[model samples]
Target: MSGLLFAALIVATPFLLQAVSPGDANWGKLSEISQAYGAVSVPLSAAALAGVVASLAYQARQTRIAQEDAHRSTHRELILLALASPALRPCWEPPFVPMTSAEWERIAFTNLIMSGWENAFRLGSLSDDQLRLTLRGHFSGAPARMHWANARDSWIELVEHGTDRRARDFARITEECFQAAVLAGPGVQAADYFIPEPTNGAGGGGS
Candidate 1:
């Protein structure tokens, strides 16, 4: 309503000026200008309304994009934090996570080490690329499957029903990607791999 009124005022301003401006303003010319202004006002007002609508639409789009970027940024920060400390890796190995799971099984993890993986898995959006890398590149397959199977009930309780869809799918996708990586092994592109349904938490369990 305000926008329409402002536009109407702009269109009306010129006619008002010509009509009221002191003396000697030809009445004949004033009448002609009034007619012209009347003819153009509606189109000018419509254009103004369109500009307002377009600005609102643009602002809405930017707001959504900002939210998504913030989501991804949160995941990135958590990934960096999880990998920051050397104390988390006592025995040493390249590219921790999946291998860390094996290392953990061989010689159980202290609470500190366990915490690193916890932040890596739980802090950010699951679909985040870094999170996916931590899952598929570092921890997928038998290791992730085994861990998830053991923790399923606890995780379900944590997430409950209203949890974010990305986080929920993250749990399921990590397990699937892990199985796929195990099947593919070295040299095959993981993307070329197919995910197998979780198999009864089969094979064996490790610490």
Candidate 2:
């Protein structure tokens, strides 16, 4: 039986038994028996009730603490993931380009997109073509993409076209994207899409 119910029974049994007892002409003996049972039942019931309440409260507190810890752990993992990403590094360092409001907006949007892409890749839901298409859409008509593409064309042009610091910054962003694609896990087939196949003696080559 449940502890609460058992405690209730302990408290009630003495009174119930007393009520049903055949009373003698003498009231003293009856009073003595009643007092003896009452003394045991009252303390037992109170102790049982206190124990049940304390156990319940402790369990609730533990559950709350576990949930809070899990939330903090997940948050910490996400921060680590962001730091491991190559894209955010340039923004943190100096010869700092003061990003205009528009540039910052684009950077934020791109980072958000990259995060989603990484998650999708990890979950085995992203395709190379889809990744390429999404990137193309985001990069179109933006300084971010223009800067990146210019850096990819040639190191000499990259140095000549922009401030040395900006060129280095663009290189880091490009490298981060490449690294993300490679490290995105077994679900991603980034090499097929991003990396070119070595030419074979035959006309056709495969990655």
Candidate 3:
């Protein structure tokens, strides 16, 4: 029970005692009432503690979701950047066809895209499955696969020279996607195994 309720009960004790024995004015009834009401406090305190724990757990879950959303937003922005910026296009550029282009522009774009992917990984924006799906878009054709195959050296280079583990992280998945693309060969299209999630339409293989 609340302190105010307990206090009110205590205040009424004198009247109860007066009524119990008007002439004797017994005070023992007041003691009994106080003990009875005080016993309710333990259960009340436990319930209050449970409520606080539940509230904190809810707040922690909300905070975790907010952070995940922020990371996902960052990843989405990176994908959208590829849409407008020629330097950051998600698909293979011209002259490369179904594979990596020897063209300087395509190489530069690949480098930039991989760097962004590394950052996204470091930020915990993309899960391994999401990253795999995102990488699938780059294997749009022979040129895309060629680009990944050709860029393998540089991806390793970044891992070797990087200060953070981000480059290493990207390199791990980069190798996986590049190998998968190579194994799939020129016949394997982006539509073959690429299904985009609705949450990130920015560079979804579907898009």
Q: Using lDDT, give the best candidate's number.
A: 3
To one decimal, what is the Cα RMSD in angstroms of model 2 from the true structure?
A: 18.0
State the lDDT of candidate 3 residue by residue for 1-207, as single tens digits: 699999999999778867777686446876788788889988999999999999999999779658866885676666456645756654533432343323434445555566567667877887788888988767656545655666667558857796656557677777888778767766354355567765866766853
Error of 2 at 81 (Å): 1.5
Error of 2 at 42 (Å): 1.6
lDDT of 1 at 187: 33
- Compared with the true structure, all predictions reach lDDT values of 0.57, 0.55, 0.67
How does candidate 2 score on lDDT? 0.55
Q: How do all models score by TM-score?
A: 0.34, 0.31, 0.39
State residue 13's C-alpha deviation in candidate 1, in Å: 11
Positional deviation of residue 185's Cα in model 2 after best superposition, in angstroms: 45
Candidate No. with top TM-score? 3
Candidate 3 lands at a TM-score of: 0.39
How well is each residue in 1-207 modelled by candidate 2, as lDDT tens digits? 699999999999878977987765356877899799999999999999999999999999679657855874675565455456746545543212455544544444454445455445433576555655555444433443433333344533554575445334434444555445444532222233356667768667678
Residue-level lDDT tens digits of model 1 in 1-207 = 999999999999878987879778787887899899998998999999999999999998679657856875675554445456545544333332344444344223222332344444554533356655665655433434444445555555655564465556555655565566667764333344577767776667787
Q: Which runs of model 1 end up more than 4 angstroms from their true locations?
A: 1-29, 86-207
Best to worst by lDDT, what's the order?
3, 1, 2
lDDT of 3: 0.67
